[model samples]
Target: MYRKIFIDDENAAHRELSIYRKGHVNAIRLNDEGYFVYQSLPISAHNYAALFHYNSIDALNALPFISETKNGLDSWDEAYLPNTLLEKLIGILGDELDAHRETKPEEIMLGWQDSPEKISYWRVISPTEFCSFLESLMAFVKEAQTTGYDLEFIL
Candidate 1:
């Protein structure tokens, strides 16, 4: 129902990792035979990236929301945010995130999934607001990296 994003240290051995759903253990095993396994941080770590993109913008925007039919993939539960968007987000949200960490207080997280009363606002966000929100997410990733985190998208 929901996807998770993870951040960890960069591993030169395994520069890229394959993404799969929780139930696709068998598929992962089959695919793993072809590549060398690289050790990663334990999943229990509080390193899970909290990035989220609402379904509305995902459906209309040209972002990297993976499509099973369009991309000839087998699962609908996995996707990745493209690197370009990721970098842009990091640049936009860096300062805000740093301030949040220093303050340790409740923050207003914006997204296209705002409450029904604010539905009109989210609907009009489309490309701009959504992009800003994504930048915040990328900022989270950048912050995590400074503390020894790498990134992963678990859908």
Candidate 2:
């Protein structure tokens, strides 16, 4: 079971993404169609805070919910990721994926994310799994773009 976040518009995915505190096994359901699976790494380092740059991740993390994930409260935090930012993220993540293909997962690391810390799952993530995560995110972003809606994380 999980708590949910809300939105003001109609086109947004309201209660799609699942957030599990025990692990990072997350999935997003686009508009009631189906589930998009993105598996987890060894440890739940940052728990997706390692996906974006400073401003974006910080904005998401700054939301009240992220701070209380461990409390198991009925609290909520905003998860509105705008399409404009996702546009840039797509290219950056794509480049990292390509680099990983050319080099090794350990070599490239999570070079896409800004300021990856020692607490991150950088050491345990595989190239295939990382690419899978990127692919799922790209699909979600593309769906949001097609619908002319900003991506909303149902955290």
Candidate 3:
């Protein structure tokens, strides 16, 4: 699945470009739609706390209805398995394996961060739609290698 994090609105590309001018974070165009995509080594360390740094419960609740899949529920705590895209995504990603096994009996906070100065977010997407989105995104990237793009999640 394509993984991503949301930081904030960048009003001017040139202004935001300065953040990466020093090469601390590698920059890649998400697609061709002009949305910035910052490439970082996929989060694996940091003790799983990074996952909670970018997810927002309010944002999640505002998303569209996502069909619950058996696979998505298998990895989530029973309390979280009722119905929701988060549960579905967890079920799909954790299939045959524990997605949040350590957090049993409780819901896991999948990466998000909040602050008065700035807001940042991260999300784990289901592999099921990863390929299709990649293909579509590839087509966009091929069209405009220099332009950035945004990948919107449809649940």
Candidate 4:
């Protein structure tokens, strides 16, 4: 069984995104000090942005749309891969695919944490949780999956 954790306060939520995508499979890890951001122009007028805080390259691969490209690695960090590897990865992430039309909200504040710092600063955050946090949520997901309710989303 997967572990389940709660993000009940400010500190936990702040570290949620970065920790969730730490080490996945084929995703890239760009260094932004305190953040992970990915953007694309999908034939649309405005570019979409997905930001987070990740731990390892494998965790990054679990991101949405990263597996439907031409080389699979276009979304991966080119700086970290060889020329041949980059080409192969791009093909995997950007293949012949239509743009996604799902209109889920950008920010989802699942819950909060118990911090003595402030009055639980209310703010929106990514849908998934960090490593420490996801262990708990994953359990909920497993249960939900049995009920035919899927709650997967991309930043």
Which lDDT value does model 3 have at 59? 26
Task: Please provide, for model 2 over 43-137, each residue's C-alpha lDDT reduced to its tens digit, 9 standing for 90 to 100.
Answer: 13232422332123333343332222442112133233344555665665466556544434332123221233322112233456555665666
Best by TM-score: 2
lDDT, residue 35, model 2: 47
Point to the candidate with the largest lDDT: 2
TM-score of 4: 0.25
List RMSD in Å for every model shown.
14.4, 14.8, 18.1, 16.3
Pairs of colliding residues, candidate 2: none
Q: Which parts of model 2 are misplaced by more than 4 Å? A: 1-79, 103-123, 153-155
Per-residue CA lDDT of candidate 1, range 8-73, in tens?
234432223332112111111112346331222222111121222223222222444344445311
Quantify all predictions' global Cα lDDT against the true fold.
0.31, 0.38, 0.29, 0.29
lDDT of 3 by residue, 1-155 (tens): 23334322243442242221111112343334664544321222121222222232222333342224422211121112112233333333333223233332322233333433333333333332333333333343233333332222211
Stretches off by above 4 angstroms in model 1 are: 1-64, 67-76, 92-96, 105-152
Query: How would you order the candidates by lDDT, starting with the best?
Result: 2, 1, 4, 3
Higher-scoring candidate on lDDT, 1 or 2: 2
Q: What C-alpha lDDT, on a 0 to 100 scale, does residue 150 get in candidate 3?
A: 22
Candidate 4 ranges beyond 4 A from true positions: 1-79, 95-103, 110-112, 117-155
The sequence of per-residue lDDT tens digits that candidate 4 reaches over residues 1-155 is: 22234333345554454322222221223333543323211110011122221222233243332233333223223223322233333332232111122323344333334553322222333323232233333343344334333232222
The ten-residue window of minimal lDDT in model 3 covers 73-82
